[model samples]
Target: MTRACATLTLFLGLPQGTMGFASSFSACRSQASAAPRTALLRAWGRTSSGSSSERQPLRHLRRRRSEGLVASLSTKGEREGNPATEEEAQLLQHLSSPPKSQRRHQQQPQQPRTSTKRGTTRKRLTSTGGLKSLPIVTPSIELLSHASRRSKKVSQDMLIKNARNRSRKWVAERMDMLGKATSKPLRDIIRQYKHQLPILHPFEATLADLTVRAREKTGERTLQSVLDDVNDFRKVALEISKSAAREGKLGEKKSEIMQTMDAGYSRMEDHFLTNGSVLEDLTEIQKSLRSLPIVQLHLPTVVLVGAPNVGKSSIVRAVSTGTPEVNSYPFTTRGMALGHMFHPETNARYQIMDTPGVLSRPDGERNEMEALTLASMQHLPTAVIFVMDLSGHSGHLSSLDNQMQVRHELRRRFPRRPWLDVVSKADLPRLELEKAKEALPEGYLDLSTLDGTGVEELKTRLFEMYEIIERILAPPPEVQR
Candidate 1:
């Protein structure tokens, strides 16, 4: 019996959890059959459960410092071999309780020494310019119970088979965020992620597949196009590998793992840089084919035009998150900024640019409006959003970067294009956007982003206008340049 127990302990490769199970079983506290318990131990990947003469070699590595993650949920930091600090012992005790989000935000400080968690709250957090905070919130034990209930509401798989996966109940309460990433087909996503899985064999790049796609998508291949994708793929692989290494969670096979990544990256890098001249022309042709449709979608862009200190940036911040710095003062946004936020449910995506403040007299500066207008034009926005300040402070609308100059430039550079107007700042009492709307005889949408009023209805109106431009301006496949 002693020899059998000793053999069973030797095969359990687990460092901490197995040792406790071994000691407990050997003590014979419960009356479960020995054969079933021994079989269970073997199923946990033990090679041999009963080799009496052989003694397993013990790990000689020193006890490492604990990673102070959600500390309250940690296990006993150290056993006889695992010596841990006093703080670690307290952390493990806290982990045994409910996680963050379970505890109220105010009570989270009393949690563990680290006291961190990701909670759900839609309150407007104070943000520094060009920055946002990432706060940790705690969760409750009732999470599992909530998930189980929701699973029943969703589907049989979600309710029954995926009971464990559905345990995250708090996620369903918020708006569906997964919809964006799920835009691609399930098969395409599976294929993309599948390529990332560690492969024992070399993954070869196919020239034929590219040829097929070139013919199918655009009926020709340009050299610049293929080279661009090749360069992009190389950059992507290197970034992915470096990020994985930086995470420091590779565990036992880290050296072997990094070596595999380095080898894979080198294989592709040598192929591209070493054999460049022969492939250059074909790549360009491929890119040209892809460019055809994109060129058609791009019309002369209409940038959100405004002066410093006049809620120009605020309208940008409110309407579309183009990252124009919003403040009570003037000239907060420095460089021309660009960002895109699509509607949650619809396929509507607005190409928005939050440009540097457009002053009447150049602040000894290059015409910021002209520069911003040119910068946005490269994107080929179907329509323009001339976001203006409506709060009784739109300084000399016709004189400042004036409407006529803007219209003349667009007509001269990109003729037969569409441009729209957006008059902002409806929240302030004295400001009347209706008067501001008259500044642009082309017409405008009256909106107040601060109050969240007129936002949705205005967006709906913008999309309707976008559809009209799409039909009128979208060029066919034959027009190359």
Candidate 2:
């Protein structure tokens, strides 16, 4: 009985000697019968509100007692020892350990987490290289009218009480449209022209300036001045639009709002019309710029220059890929003609230009066509092939004396250029040819395009001249230590 009392005390985690053996057995039976499983477990120190150290021994004793009780209950019918009662066995099974679900949850492993953030992409802008890549400029008047039409299409679905808000929105939208039309195009043109003008090849730059000067009227706004005026108008228009919108917001009556907006619109229209000619001038300049040739400055160039009807175009057509008109009149090749040739051995490319005929005259007295030839001589890195008509039989107009004077003037102006003289019409009558040879300067190349005489020789010598030019222009070789 005492041993049974001690065993009951260990299972209940109660103080020793607290009950007599008879009392302890009865107490255990009464407690198991009267209290709930959870209450009994709390008394057994499984979840008791005692200090951890005080509860620890009780917990160990309860675990061992429950194991023994379970073993005894499992062998109740087979063993000879006294067995546990049904209530005590049920309490032990429920309170000795955690629930099955919770134990399973604690035994499982957790998974690692991954990030879900996305990366951002950026856009890149491409650049047009130079003036040759400039797009066509839009006409200012058309742009202005288009903007006005777009602004007029704004929605007018506002309440009557929101007249002031509506007016502000309308005015803001209209001002934005006006700026896009007038200021934006002008700004783009100014930016492109300013950027490209300085980088233009010298000959192209001079030709462009001459073209602009020819179209410009006296006492009027120049291209830059017109651009400035348009920009100023943009600022002024913005200020006027803001003031008008503010006035509309302050207006009490609908008529006052309408009047204010109408007045602002009228002022802007009048300002644009005042500078209508400026827009026209800008349009004309765009046309002229687009008309200019796209000259490649990297290649070697050979330029043909002589008086009109002196077989300059004929020689160009015979020697290069050019096919200029072979007319017997003066200034047949009105503009600069460009062609290409290739070196046989090196596979290098060359530019051949046939310019309009230039007469022997002072700079001030020269025409636009002649000015083009002069611009080439003054600007381009080239070899000059001065064609002469000593036979005077191909309807040539310039006298031999005048042609010689022109040659002397060009040589004096550009003394460093490589020059080659060619006397055309070698197939003329024997008497005229002999007379021409007598009058010709030493080292003249006689050629007849009609029968291809000296054509191949001329091409070879031209390539040799270019070789000399290349040698002069090339960078010096590096020296070894």
Candidate 3:
């Protein structure tokens, strides 16, 4: 076919020579004149089929986009040294695909292509977040124990030296010997037991009670009482030793002198233990007390109470100056933990104490840990913070059951105590929003320790509670009598 006829046939998508040659040529010339001109893209010595010419417009449109994309990609690839970036692959895909309408019209079934998500590596979530440490009471249990043991050893050493070097010395020398032997060790024992009264503030005392297992022999004899007994024994021993030395039997009754000192030591040791033997319970109490957080009773206190694994510790760690151990399983916090919240804006400091989980169990059946919770609430002038975990992740009981049981117990037992109910784990999907609301106390808060939801509101409410308490406790303005 002639070039003009061929061009006209291709443009019309018709059979060759369907029209007369002169007519075809005229049609081609008319079409060429009417068609908007485009720059001709040179073929790179590649053979072209008739369909290629038919697809020329689409190819030209894609060519411009492809060239620009590839040039940018080439520069980036040279710098990065990686081939076929995600953007390049996506752009090329769009460029290569036919129009949506055309694809829809096609009858061919497309194979479903699998695509991998980029940057989807799973993140490792820690069971607990780091938190600030509280100014805890550390009595140096190891050092104290070591010193106590060493003092006894030194006293025994002195006794042995006195026995070995029995000088028939004067009354003054013998009295000095007995006094040094008795007083030094007695003083050490007294020092070990005696604590500054101020250090054991009401909260600290309660913490000692909750954390330490003090052995009560006749009912009310405390650590202070034991130390007082030791002090009295020291005075008695000194008197006896001086009297014996003055009577001129100091050297003659060496065994008696040793026995007198031994009796005083035995008395002091017996008060700490049952059989004047190993001070097991007292030692354990000391260890526990030393580890306890030194909570100040002066600040406004808030105590958290809830079922185990109800995010109590999590909230404390997030908002306070304490970092209690947090785990998915229940009862991670076995003892009372202390923390403090300092509000910079209001300049209000609130002491936060997280008590061990209190279960919905019988009073008699309740263990020591649960008893500690009750003791703290009953004794401390605290604003109660009870967390309701609607997520049902809290151990042993359903959210509704926990709320109902805790409410019943608190109302029946501590009706007059002021408390705030907070719903924890608010970031989790809440399937029981209405149910939880109905079950929860009035003015309940939804809080998330993870995302810090409703924390500020909680702090504000706590401050408000403090202010109200302050007003109530404040002496009424002087009556104009």
Candidate 4:
């Protein structure tokens, strides 16, 4: 019986002391007769050592079983030997802890910062002259683009797939969405422009005021009036939305709540459309404002002013960054154009303005283009470069007549301010030049834009005048031992 159990254990690849195999053998002994046991033994012995063909099948079966057991054991051993899982656990723990740099930052003292205004807010930056503050110009497209992005954000963040049909929370959510949709665009436009307008330099503010007042609308509406309308309408729409939501909650109708939301949104859109003229005007104003040159008090400005067809723009193109249209017609420049010139060595930059042609006619005859030039000359700290066409070929105004007109209004008005009288189109005719030279102040330049005559001397003279002004305006140096 012991031998039979051992043989069974050997065949199954178990130790001889294994009770499981012994029990199985005992059970087989009880169930089967002695003849069956003897038959099994005979089968085993024959299978072990017969002909080569007979032994081959049993050998292959045993090898396959041994190989499978070895493969299973090796797989288990590899799994036990691997350190990847342990390393991952350690790495995860390390990441979960706060970094040393963060901890050190937390221990450091934080300084409180104050808001700094762009340019000066006070009336005068220095005692000598009152310079207007510079305001950052915001484009209309910028405001509209911001509004679009904000609306898209609100839609994405507030999506509702399932809501309790007409519950209080759902109704509230709908109202919130409605309010956001209605108020965002309108409020954004008005609020931003309103805020920007107030803090601007007086010159800019006046310009803005003039621009806003110029547009023909249904009713007279200033920037403040537009803002008031938007604010009032917003409040009304939000209230209406809230009332609608309340009614929806009382009755179990999500449709009713949504209808109210739509109504509110429509009202908001209507409010914007009703002020459509204002928006159109504002967009036009933005273009003009963007074109308006930033006036810097510290830097010198050379303004070229003349009647139309007089080469004011040509001289500007020659001397500065401005490229004004030069042609043989009146009012060639519809608006003022600006250019920049930087002095070498000191690297100091200044502005050169090419103003729209101002006719020698009366004030009532002047247009908006002329008004813009007049405003700059009256307000901005600048020197005048009165350009005259030496050629009387255009027949609008003779060189002598043009020079006399400039001297009458501009020169008489700002006598203290430095002036540069330039006769352009020098290549045209010596006849007009000789006639114009009689009325010209000393050092008046004869310049031709096409031939590049007298442009360098003009630039040198401009810079020299700028330096002289800077020297005079510059505060006295402290007395040193």
Candidate 5:
């Protein structure tokens, strides 16, 4: 029996005298029948021969020994009301759990997948996606001749003029030079305009459209038509240059090469002469666009608007960093002016814009100044401060009724916008008409920029409006988290 236990321990891969080995062997001897014991001993004796064919009998013996040990443990547990011993429980746990390599794989962090394609980088979007600034557009004639000037400079090189096979080389060179010169500049200008048009803020786009319309000639051409014409001329010029150069290359004639180059130059000149007015108009439009006030859309803005000479500029000058021209006459603020104010405690910045006076008239009848004011109120994300002068002391171009009509019309057009009303030039005596008094909205703020009355309150209210706008524009909590 001692030899049998020793042999069993060696086959089971457990150390001698270990608690598990001792427990398992003793359990197997006590619980196993005589027939199984004899069979296991016979198998062990065969394994001692060290024959490869005898290894199966040894494995069978070890499996039977394990079964006997488990049966003994289970029967004893039944009597004791427990199903397994500590050693048996540990054996089962080791069998049930995953392998060490698999557990390690599960514990490791995953990495983000990388893309291998070119130019697939992500771009960040701005809060307002508006143009930050306008690109400088070169003057019409200068821009048209820029490529020619560059080509001329390149042609002036002595080595280029005196190279071997000069006529053939010059014809090919001139083909490339003239083709690129005639087309590239025009293409660049077209690309610039195309790129800028799509990203323009709505207000600026409206102004641009109005400017183009004002300069448009009847039954002649628009800016876009002129651009199309330039493109067509570019194509024609390229075709002419390539055709002439190909003919010149077949047989090198200096006179014919010069004539081919002259043809290309003449095509370019014809394009410029035909589209000169439209080109000048485009240049002027670019200048106008650049002159426009740069409004930061992310900042909470308050736009001051009303009829001519109602002291909108005065309010802007009093409450904000803007110093718009204050005058006794109408249309003092012919253009948009942007200014800023900062909260004393939070240091949050707010924008204030002074726009030109809008007249109470149909859209088609409105002048450029009126159109500009209307554009501001229509498109900007802003609070409107409609300034009214009840004293009849303004340039008198706009009566009290006209001012009220302008306010009502604007409010009707842009309902649900943050709005306020102000009676400017408060020190002067007001109109005695009861109708004007009744027409005035309740809680309208009255202030005199001359003596600073109610300016502090206006600033306070503007800051409060900014806070409300900030909450409205804030990102959701989940996104912020």
Candidate 6:
């Protein structure tokens, strides 16, 4: 009876169904084995009452006995039997929690994280708990791979979108910059200049707007956009130049106008050189820097050829800034003189040479003035500028025979050269002007140089005349616009 009470007291200390195993394990030595078996059968409700699924709780213990998965319980049960068995039996009750490592990690000797990822082999437990190396999930690599794929996909999408946006912006800017009117063709000689100008039309217009108007109404802020667009204007100009030059029509005003710029001369030079076109003609135009003394070949050079004291030097001094040897005598100018005049609009310049005096007399060497003027044109055979005095009626003129001789010599020597005519001293009486006009060549200009009366007008007319003469003398092979 005292033994039964002791066994009952121990049974009270254990968990529910575990009390059956506890009693059986302890009571075999302490009391009745049959009593423990009866208690186990009662705790189970009945020995036959447990279902197959309900009987599954003991399956782990049965399986663990074979696999030795319960080492902690096995060792502890052999040493301090009852309670250790009870604790292990309770441990097997739930799967959510795992047993602590039996080796106690040796406190790991405070191992650094540098320990190998491969775990130390587990030891059989000497205590009531054990650890199994669970599958080590590499959270970092999985996460990194996923994130990398997602980020790469996102980056690719962004790059494509950005490129599309830039293309759209570029198209918008290009269209806006090259408005409508400037894109049209230029027509007429007195009208628009048809040549593609050196300055890019867009940029040139923008710069021009910036200077004249304090603010641009185009609604753009960055100068970079403006500059970017203007660069192409020079390209258009180069195209025109190349086309014109290829056809040998580069000198025609309507054709050459395509290569000029309203911006300035330097701008044209920049646009021309940007595309690497050879500027041989420009070198000839700005010939001041030329090392060799240049001669204009077979060019019509009309000199101020007249008798001294008839105001021949006056005409040279009046039209250009030439300071001739002026005196109130017949033999004042001992030698020939040279001067030049320039006009911007038609792009004309004249090299006027003043002479002594000319006469109708048929001497072998001729008059001092007539001799020098004719001699220069006779050899080079351009044109002659006769500065005849138109102040008196029935003027002392070069005879038809003498005129015929000069024309014959020029036609024989330089057949392709051009000639220009001039009737000087227009401020004279109208009667003398009309009489002088009858005595001169077909397309003659009357000039009074002192007052700049016909100076600029004459320059435009002369330059226009030069164009006609230039076209007639040197027709272009190409029909470039």
Top-scoring candidate (lDDT): 5
Q: Each prediction's Cα lDDT score?
A: 0.33, 0.52, 0.44, 0.47, 0.53, 0.32
Q: Write the per-residue lDDT of candidate 1 for residues 290-334, one digit (tens) a residue.
A: 222111123222346554445545555555645533211111125
**Tens digits of lDDT, candidate 6, 241-261:** 333233232223422232221
Provide the lowest-lDDT 10-residue window in model 3.
21-30
Between candidates 2 and 3, which one is better according to lDDT? Answer: 2
**TM-score of the candidate numbered 3?**
0.47
C-alpha TM-scores of all predictions = 0.30, 0.60, 0.47, 0.54, 0.61, 0.29
Location of the lowest summed lDDT over 10 successive residues in candidate 1: 197-206
| Poorest 10 consecutive residues by lDDT, candidate 6 | 20-29
- Clash count, predicted structure 1: 34
Error of 2 at 277 (Å): 5.0
What is the lDDT ranking, best to worst?
Answer: 5, 2, 4, 3, 1, 6
Candidate 1, superposed: residue stretches over 4 Å from native:
1-302, 321-333, 343-348, 359-365, 378-382, 390-415, 429-442, 468-481
Deviation in angstroms for 2 in model 2? 99
Displacement of residue 106 (Cα, Å) in model 2 is 82
Model 3, 262-319: lDDT tens digits are: 3333322222222111122233334444555433333556778987778887778877
Instruction: Report the alpha-carbon TM-score of model 2 versus the true structure.
Output: 0.60
Candidate with the greatest TM-score versus the true structure: 5
lDDT of 4 at 279: 38
- Give the distance in Å from residue 137's predicted Cα in candidate 5 to where it truly belongs: 5.4
RMSD list, candidates in order? 31.1, 45.4, 43.6, 39.4, 38.0, 54.9
Tell me the tens digit of each residue's lDDT in model 5 across 1-481. Answer: 2222222111111111111111211100011111222232232221112211111110111112222211211122223421112222222222233554564443321211111124232211122333334445454345444655554543423555643347666656655675677667666876765444433444544454555444442233344444454455556556655765675566546665555555444544444444434445444445644554455666777888898888877778788754543221111235565668888998888888887887888866877677666655544556788899888877666788889899988887655557889988888888744667889999899899998889999998888777755543443222111
Model 4, position 456, has a per-residue lDDT of 86
